[model samples]
Target: MVLKKLVRYIINKYLKDYIEQLDYEKLKLDLKNGHVCLENLHLKPEALTDLSLPVTVATGCLEKFTLIIPWKNLYSMPTKVQIDGFYMLIVPKNGK
Candidate 1:
């Protein structure tokens, strides 16, 4: 499956790099059925506030790409998330 291949590539490239920057004791990634699951993740409060809240991404898999960001990391900011093809973006809401 091409989607499976893409997922594997993503895991090997971006995901691995992202995980390496995180504290191992706070986060873990699990791969199953061509999906990547992030478990027991923790993010800094300041990081959350500065984060691009609305995230967007595309997946050809039968399952949706899920990102479980902790509430403490949300910071009640309006987020604009958009997904188009292979592109994803998380940006501050512009009151639209």
Candidate 2:
């Protein structure tokens, strides 16, 4: 239980910059197998800031986000990431 909270805290802290209104209730973490998943994530316009594009995201959402880590073989195997049902609405910046 404590580990779950810690994981949640860490994820929320790092993801806050990109995700808007991230639903913690929907987060699932399995430390035993090193799996993390989040569903129905809404994204903020600033989420794309690092991309440095001339457009902005008017709205965005992801149905599912998953991360898998091979804890047993941490050094041998590669971590995996999967995103599903990603939807985004983009618009050009006024000045750009």
> What is the model-wide C-alpha lDDT for candidate 2?
0.88
Best prediction by lDDT: 2
Residue-by-residue lDDT tens digits, candidate 2, 1-87: 997888788778888998998787888888898999999998999788899999888999999988888989999999888899999
- Residue 38, candidate 2: alpha-carbon lDDT: 95
As a whole number from 0 to 100, the lDDT of residue 59 in candidate 2 is: 96
| RMSD of each predicted structure | 15.8, 1.8
lDDT of each: 0.35, 0.88
Worst 10 residues of 2 by lDDT: 3-12
Candidate 2 clashes between residue pairs 3 or more apart in a chain or in different chains: none
- Clashing residue pairs in candidate 1, if any? 56-88
Off by over 4 Å in 1: 20-36, 41-96
Models 1 onward score TM values of 0.24, 0.85
